[model samples]
Target chain A: MTLAQWSFDLLLAGGLLWLGWQALFEKRRFSAVVHFMAFNLLMALVWVRLSAPDIALAEAAIGAGVTGALLLTALGRLPSGTSSGAHPHRWHPHWRYLAVISACISTAWLIAVVPQLPSPGLAGEIEAVMPATGVDHAVTAVLLNIRALDTLLEVAVMLAAVVLVWSLGPTLRPLPPATILPGLPALSRLLHPLFLLVPTYLLWRGTHAPGGAFPAGAVLGAGGVLMLLADEVGWMQRQHWQRLLRLLLVSGLALFVLVGLGGLLMTGTFLSIPLGVARLLIMAVEIAMALSIALMLMALYLYGEPGQ
Target chain B: MSDYYATVAALLCGMAVIGLFRAHDLLHRILALNVLASAVFLLLVTLARTESGTDPVPHVMVLTGIVVAVSTTAAALALTIRAYERRRQREDER
Candidate 1:
């Protein structure tokens, strides 16, 4: 390994640790949010360094961008006393001491054991079966084809989360009503085109490269969030769009299940697309997943009960 | 090598766990959980690397993990925010 590469790696690792500590220990809520966002950005870079560009793109969009927005919104909405600062509690000292000790032991155990574990070399297996999946990108192939049940369940999880948040419902009042911040309208208008274009490009490139439904969905979700914050999402609550929103919310999982059922009826196995139509099926599923994931993420962000 | 990342991941895991124990605030606890999730992903990706290249399976897993983490975080923060508001209202009545 080159000296420069080693130095870069060390620097990145050190920065991540410092940022994480600051995010955790900062007394002020705003500073902690800043630190956490920085930590997320650095984490994305680390993924890229680790040679997982697909994961890197998803991390940057969903992990850093959408999650940061959610945290900041929660910070704004939370009652005053319960800000980010650690509150005093009985038995705090004992618990903290125990925590530190456990942390040390676990760290030691992982360090000692991780290197000794064998690599299952799943990459080669993925490569060998790549031709059958019809997607050129291995990550997409695995996500949409080989181990697709996980992805289907993942979509279900997102929908379930939105349901959970909605079931919690609005508090005594509906979150102080959404207010438009200064300059947000102009900003949303300016970036609106990019949101549509980027997600489309991402979905197209996903069949061949390091982009896919998740990142594309995240980008679109961000756009939805921007619209929400700008108070431009009133149309979403209209009677006509309500059903559309509901349908979009469940489309990914529904399409996924239907395709799996189709495979079962045609072939003996479930979710096994025939070789001739693999590419089309995968693309159809990816597009549906992207749309459904985007709507689900945006709904999760709004934190409003759907039927209200 | 990937081992260096593994060590970093371990340290991060430790920090996050400690943070969770000490964080009394709900937001702090959620943030700690996020850090811990990041550590797990780092470990997975580091382990996925082979002599030829990185494994797509773990990469896909981490991608799924990121989405799941966000969904859970959103739900958790929503609950926390509602609880805090309810507590404030009760104090007001008192």
Candidate 2:
């Protein structure tokens, strides 16, 4: 790498480290939140530096945007009277700390040894067949085709998490309006239209670009969370839409499973849909999954209770 | 050239980890975690760039990691907020 590249890397790393340290050492909860936001933005820069534009987009939106918003909201809900000073008792117990230290040491040792491990001979074989899958991106091929079962299971896990949160209780408990921020209503109204369009664009672009269903869904879910915070969805309206959302939530998984099973009938293998049909099927599944994930995330965020 | 840059990046990762360990508040811990994650991504990208032929595998992995991280963060934040709300309610009851 050129000197410029080396310096840039150093600067990025230094910035990240500084933010991390500040976040952990900071005494004030509010300052910690700010540091966390800065850390996330730096992480996004790291993604860009890594040449992963898709990841950068998702990290910026979901990591910095939605996660920060949620943290701040949570902090706002905290009792104002709680002592904000140092609480030594809050730290993990000595045995717990020792256990964590051992775990970290082992993990570091494993990672250090990874580079010395022998490479599998099948890497070339996997690469050779990648182009035939109609996806140029090997990672995409792995996720959407070669090992789609794992991806399917991941989606199921997300759904299960939503369900777990939902079952907790009535998440729509009316807090005293005192916690609502000023001008949130106007802000939500202005951003609502853009929210609807951006996710669709992201989803569509995933076919040829770095964007995909997961990021798009998270962005849409963030928008939904914003609407909820602004109280834009009244109790009755939320209840009315809940039923529709329930269907969309499962539609993606249903499509994926059905298409995979259908392929078995014709091709004698699970998820073996033809290349031409696979693209269409994958896109359809992504869209359905996006919708489902978005709704599920929004519900999870708003309800603050998992398993329903 | 890439080796030099990678060395710097690796050092930064060490610093970020130290910060994460030192942080006392939840928000700070999250921030430190993000920093740690950034370092990992940087290392991966640097490794990818060192290849004689540009391979998109690292790029794809980074993208997937980003999405997963965000989803995990969103859920974690929701839980945090819920916990805070509960604590507040309990305090009021007392």
Candidate 3:
């Protein structure tokens, strides 16, 4: 690498370490969250340095964006008077020192073994079969075709998460409400149309490029969150609407399983799509997965039945 | 060069463990767990980079992991909030 490139990488590494330290040692929980979000954005840049744009997009969009929103929501729900950041014992916890020592030892052990790790592992193998999977992107092929069972189960896990969150009971509303969109019509107008196009574009681009279902679903879910934040009477408030939302939450997993079963009947193995029409099958599954994943994420943000 | 990145990733992991151990609040613990997950993802992506090109398999694995991490975080936060509300309600009744 050139001097410039090496310096950039060093900068990213330094930034990540410093930000992580700030996030952990900060006195206030809010500042820690801010540092953590900054750390995530930097990590996405590190992924790009490592030549993995797909991971970079997911890291930035979901890891930083959606997760930050979730953390802030939880932070808002905590008792305001509790001083949640203040620990009774200001002194460093002794066990934490021990934990750090153990972690360092393990990290040393990992470093010793990392040099021996094989390279080009499963990439050539996956790439060779990419044509059969009907996706130009090798990552998509692995996710939606070759190792699709894992993806199917992941969808199920997300569905279960929504169900679990729903059981927690009702939306935690901020008093006075945060529907500030009326004050900023320009911001609302810009976001409203952009949300629609971005998700669709990301989904469409997934077949060939770094963008895919996860980021698309995340973007869609973020839009849902923005809508929820805008008004007191949110989208999922009605009793009848709750039933439909629940169905939408599970629809992705249901469609994935049904498709897998169909694939099994067509071929000998589970989730094995025939070589013919692989593109059609994969796209259909992705669309269903994106829609369901979007609803599941949004439902998690809403957290239980929408309060009246 | 990749090894350098990997070392940083490992150190981040160490930081995460320490943060989790020291953090008293549920939200703090969750944040540390997220830092830990990001460390693991960084390690995998860095390792997947080869002399030829990057591996796609690990990329997908990390992508799946990111989604799973968000889902679990949401569930944990919901539970934390619910417990807090329940305790406050009980105190009010008393």
Q: Which candidate leads in DockQ?
A: 1
B82 Cα displacement, candidate 2 (Å):
4.9
Tens digit of per-residue lDDT, candidate 1, span A1-308: 89999999989999999999999888677788889999999999999898888888888888888899889888888755645333556576777678688789978998889898787688778889998888899989999999999999999899889888878864223322356468887888999999999999999999999898988998898888877777677766566777888888999999999999999988879999887888999999999999998888888877776545
Best by lDDT: 1
- Sort the candidates on lDDT, descending order: 1, 3, 2
Better of 1 and 2 by lDDT: 1
Candidate 1 CAPRI classification by DockQ: medium
Taking the tens digit of each residue's C-alpha lDDT, what string does model 2 give over B1-94?
A: 3344355456556656666665555545555666666667666665665344434555555555554554565555555555666766788999
Tell me how each candidate scores on DockQ against the true complex. 0.71, 0.33, 0.63
Which is the winner by DockQ between candidate 1 and candidate 3? 1
Which wins on lDDT, candidate 1 or candidate 3? Answer: 1
Which of candidates 1 and 3 is the stronger one according to TM-score?
1
Mark the regions of model 3 whose C-alpha exceeds 4 Å error after superposition: A80-97, A174-186
Worst 10 residues of 3 chain A by lDDT: A175-184
Model 2 chain A scores worst on lDDT over the 10 consecutive residues at A114-123
**Interface residue Cα RMSD of candidate 1 after superposition:** 1.9
- Scored by Cα lDDT, where does model 3 land? 0.80
lDDT of 2 by residue, A112-160 (tens): 6535443223345557787667665555666677767866777776777
Q: How do all models score by TM-score?
A: 0.94, 0.78, 0.92
Q: Which runs of model 2 end up more than 4 angstroms from their true locations?
A: A1-6, A79-127, A136-139, A172-183, A235-237, A305-308, B1-62, B74-94
